[model samples]
Target: MVRIAYDPTPYHFNHGVLELPDIVARLGYEYMQLTPHPEFGPFHRMPKADDELVAALKKRAADAGVKIVALQPVQRISWPEEPQREAAVRNFKRVIEITAQLGVDTINTEFSGRPERSEDSEAGFYRSMEELIPVAEKEGVRINIDPHPDDFVEDGLEAWRVIRGLNSKQVGFVYVGSHSFHMGNQAATLLPQVGDRLGAVFAADTYDHHRSNGLRYITNPPGNSVRVHQHQEIGNGDVDWNELFDTLGKIGYLDREDAVIVSNVFGENEDAEGSALRQLDKIRELISGAAR
Candidate 1:
């Protein structure tokens, strides 16, 4: 009962494209995670997009029968300078508002960053959440902070700090298995701690040796010497996805509302797309087999 989704970034898809909804639908994903155009810094802080454009996008998604699950931010905002940080928070607030209007309930961002070793890194997380949580509560959308590889709070333990620091139901975490695999944490043990507070999980392939080495590629895939975190299609990486899915199931995530496990496919070539879709199909079949 685990639902699957695609990040749609590397595939040259975004909100601006009028064809995105149809593309997502045709890809057979149940949820679409929207990202801000790179030029706009991922959150698209232009206040409101053209109403006509919004209407058209909404209509297309409706026609395609896909749900827009969460609004994702551009990566830069995660570890911005102090001066730029406030504006990033403001922009994130606006993104949540936009999602709320669209009837979506989650705002996903790279805001869970680790600042340069300072007194504020720990306090800053709480301070930032205090400002945003009220806005999220008001807008009726939850905030999901993604734990990126190099960012502050990149691993599950650090992510737990922010999640526990905020102590607000409105704030949650997005656990990317690649992130966990990169950190070499036991996914089964870490997942239950986050549980439903896990707004979403990015299920992609990661090479254990590569992820362990901070994503550096000393060797290439199939080369027998590569150890970098190459974002491979699912079923091709070192992670035991069946065990990962079982862990998710044990946490009562099966068929839960907004339970989205998306694949953040790195390469955008046609081969990558085929590989991604194939991975999803395999995952769907695996989950079904597990249920039976």
Candidate 2:
């Protein structure tokens, strides 16, 4: 029963936001998850969508027989700087409003905070959450956080601890397959722990930088710290698709009505449609295999 949503980021540049529904339907997906789009909103910026725009998008999706299952807006709501954090909060409020208007109850986003200033950024994150949780609660929208690379918390278990500290069911976790290694490559361990709080799963492949004794990628300075990953087509990289899906099945994530699986392949833009189709096919295969 897990809902599968297609991310239209690959088509955003060539097609406008208004045209995304048709594009997604053409790709044979019944559900669409709106990622950061310039016309609607971009990363770290306030939303540009108004009431009229929201209405138009809703009608368009309905006409195309596609449902907008979720919205993803990447704002720096956890910025260490006070002014930036304030603006991000304002932007996030609008994001929640849009989600409500679209009849979508899920907002998948990141803890967009500074990694270097971890303490201050963590404080800013909690402050912003304190202010926004009420709004999300009122709107009946759940916020799922991704502990992205360079964020205040990137490890999967630690990020779960941070989200758990909030003590609100309105907040949850996003497990992006591409970030598996950065998140400790412990899907078996993390997914079971996240359990019912795991809001969404993003399907994309990424190489294991820890492979080959860390010589897979090399930088000029030996000691330089950097996180390298990719949103490649499923099975094109190191993620163990069978193991990941099996874990979800074990945790009962694959059987939840609210469970969302998103196809977010971005590495093969030149053949976006092909990648989308393959992701959909693979996701369905995985789900079928995961059925207990």
Candidate 3:
């Protein structure tokens, strides 16, 4: 069955990394996706988690009856600069080791490149992949990439094509619902192309900034590039939930064992508890509706 996981980012400010499993269980989720955290793995740096911390975190999650579905670490693996790319490769290898130690098999991360230097950044990505793909394969871990806004490749299909270029079964793609607009709002087409290689879907909502003749958001400088999106609760934004789920079901992602749907609302942390519960309820409702 497709697993529903929780991204504990809203609670990161208050909760320690080791305490995340209990927090997720309290929110009525059976699985958790560990995002960047200071004690575990911070963004754009080496992982801070030692072996002792890894063992303790594993025990904590087990005791809480919460399974870890994936680990998310944002590294400059696609950096155009050679030094950062090489360091990211080394850190990525260590992340695989940490992932294996925790008994997890999935790592989802961003491309971490610049739009102005896409070609160079893409080359760096390939070089880093050449070194780390073997390590991930040996460790039995799959790496999924999210083409985040402002990165080298923000379009959904293009990102998939870039990932496909790697020619490795272990590399996959992540489709984020909240980024629907920035990615050209083509889930119907993109998800089909992703097919079984689609590793995870992030559940959040955002308004389409491309609407109203590009006046949905008015930048101060009038045409300066700025990525606009939000992590609102499911129904609050413009994401076509039914259509997304239908496409997912059509592509067989709804029934796949390795497929994960993550709740990653970030805009409303003051009422995070309620938002998380609502998101879980809504995800189940959509999944149920899709199944029928």
Candidate 4:
């Protein structure tokens, strides 16, 4: 069975971390992918969590009957600078320690490669992984890295290569539906290419830009240079949900013991709770249909 998880990215800005479990459970979701928060350092660049905070968060989730299946620590580890890179590695080590304490086994993140210096960034990524991989193994945690649009290793094939290079079962790839355009055109083909390294997935939709010729939509001047995409409700965008689910079934993702299918829709909408519940229903229906 494919365990469907709800990610609280939309609520990260408005809701307190302690309140997430209740919201997730109320939406009828059994699992959650905890995002970074200012109070808990968002688990991004070294959380502000000590033993007390970690214990509190874990207890809160347990009390609400929501299992924290994964934690997303959004940090830039591909910095070419030496000191900053070392600090990122250290921060990730702390994140892994927190993951172990919370009894969660997975950490999802972007490769976060530097756009300007691709080669240096790739080297930096490998160097950081060398230090962090052993720590992950020791703590019994899996690292699932994805190919974000502007990251150095943005290509799906390249991301898989990096995961394979790590040469550890604890490392794997995440297929973000919101990044399908940037990942590649053939979702059916690309997904299976990751093969057994496919550990988790970010279930959301994005506006298709394959035919736009780079003239799709403009955010604003002076915005972050990276190309951004939406994490809208599944059927609201161009992601082929039927095809995605069918492909997943063909790959036996639903049967994998460690597979995580997360509903990660984020926007400035008012009814986040309603939106999440709706997405959960859609995901469940698709998974069930695929099984049949």
Candidate 5:
């Protein structure tokens, strides 16, 4: 059976960990992919949370019957300089430890560009991977690097190359269709290879060319730009879902099972919760139809 998962980034402002499972369960998604933005707010970070607290959170979700597909930790390990870079690495390790305690195997993150020379940036990337890879292995977790348009590694090809260079099975790609569409309309050609390094998939929409940088840019209020133009819902954009879904299926995505997809619905702070629910409902319908 295909497992459907939701990324909580869309409605994160309106909800918290405590209320997430219920909302997710209510929407009919089997798994919930938590986008743990450390700086987002107090409720989402849980930095000082111990095993007992972590277990409680997991128990709450389980009690609600919403499994954790993965934890998407953004900017958890992205830094421009060495000192800040080290700090980012430490934060990332903490997140890995949390995932380990929570019984989650996938930790999704990104590598922001280094403002150094090209060769220096390449060197820093490998160095960063080497630094972070062992923590993932030690924790028995897969490090998912989802490509963002503004990041150093934004497209499928570069991500593949980085993973190959790292040469560890612990690293994989979280194929974000919006970024793929904006960076290059290559998800179709990339899907086959995507399966090979597949860690997760974030189902989102974007325009033909604007700010599809994987960072949702809410030109509206709440001032979040991780992804561009949070739009109202899926299938309301120019992204070719049919072909993308078909290609994903061919690559063994299996509708909602092979990967976890999250919807990035843009809206004002007051309308956030409704937008997320709306996106979730629409996606459930879309995936259901696609599966058929």
Candidate 6:
């Protein structure tokens, strides 16, 4: 059944790997999605988590009564150059090995490629997948790709197309709630469209710019200025919670172990643990109401 998972990204910036599981357990969450931290080595490049480190982290999670159900490694899997693409493939293989060791069957990430070079990036992405899909199948790990604002394939429908092109059950789509506007402001439409291929949901609320023309935020040039959103708690933003859950239910996504719903809110000066607990309660309420 739909276990609510906490993503330790806000904590990763302030805490180390060994110290995170206890915090998560204290917040009353048994499942988590582990994010990359410097202490654990860069997930994009050659990750340095050896056997010893992996075992230690696994033990820590067990001691705290937490199950790491998913691992998120933020890497540019669609780099245009052959050498860089090969390196990304190697790094992803290492991540899959670690996922197996931690007893996690899923890895969630973005189809990160440069927006300026979409065609070349997509070619590189398929090439990398050609090499990595076999490793994922061998390790019994499933990869869930999401559409990020700056990624080459940012549209929800297009992301689904990429997953379909892969044509492997081991690969699926993750819908990030905060990216609804960037993905075409049609979460209600897209959720049902993804249907069974929807592997996970990064649950958070986001403002709908269509109603409010106010500038959300600004970033320096050469960076992703088109992206403007926040990962806020439910009800703080414009995401229709009831509609989202209703769509999920319509697609038969409720009460399933494999259909994960993760609370992943990121911001500065926010109480990470407190916010996580609040988000969990909100999600549980939504699920309870949906069941009725």
Q: Candidate 6 at residue 16, lDDT? A: 83
lDDT of 4 by residue, 1-114 (tens): 679999987777878888889888988999999887887865336678899988999999999999999988877777778888888888899999999999999999888777
The residue-by-residue lDDT of candidate 6 on 1-292, one tens digit each, is 7888988878876788888889889989989889887777576777777899889999999999999889889777898777777778888888989999888899999888888888999999898898889998999999999988888888899888988898888898998989887788676788777778899998988887656354455446534447678888888888888888878877788866688899988863367777888899999988877732
- Which residue runs does candidate 3 get wrong by more than 4 Å? none
Flag clash pairs in model 1.
Answer: 36-42, 114-152, 210-227, 210-228, 219-226
TM-score head-to-head 1 vs 6, winner: 6
Cα-based TM-score, every candidate:
0.84, 0.98, 0.98, 0.94, 0.81, 0.94
Give the lDDT of residue 54 in candidate 5.
77
For model 2, how does the per-residue alpha-carbon lDDT over 1-292 read when each residue is reduced to its tens digit? 8989999998888889999999999999999999999999888889999999999999999999999999999999889999999999999999999999999999999999988999999999999999999999999999999999888899999999999999999999999999999999999898899999999999999999999999999997896878899999888999998999999998999999999999999889999988999889999999999835
Reference-based TM-score, model 2: 0.98
Compose the digit string of candidate 1's lDDT tens values, residues 1-292.
5567767766554335566677777777877877665432344244445555556766777888988877776533443356556666676666666677677887777654553532355555556666778888988998777766555555676666667677788878777766655455667787788877878877777767644554444444445522246566776667787787787777877568668777776754557557667867876865665421
| TM-score of candidate 3 against the unseen true structure | 0.98
Predicted structure 3: lDDT: 0.94
Predict model 6's lDDT versus the native. 0.84
Q: Which segments of model 5 are wrong by more than 4 Å?
A: 37-48, 76-78, 114-119, 210-232, 255-258, 266-292
lDDT to native, each model: 0.66, 0.94, 0.94, 0.85, 0.66, 0.84
Candidate closer to the true structure by TM-score (higher is better), 1 or 5: 1
Question: Where does the lowest 10-residue lDDT sum fall in candidate 1?
Answer: 38-47
Model 3: per-residue lDDT, tens digit, 223-262?
7978999999999999999999989888899999989999
Model 6 CA deviation exceeding 4 Å by range: 41-43, 213-225
lDDT of 1 at 185: 60
- How far off is residue 246 in model 3, in Å? 0.4
Candidate 4 local Cα displacement, residue 198, angstroms? 0.8
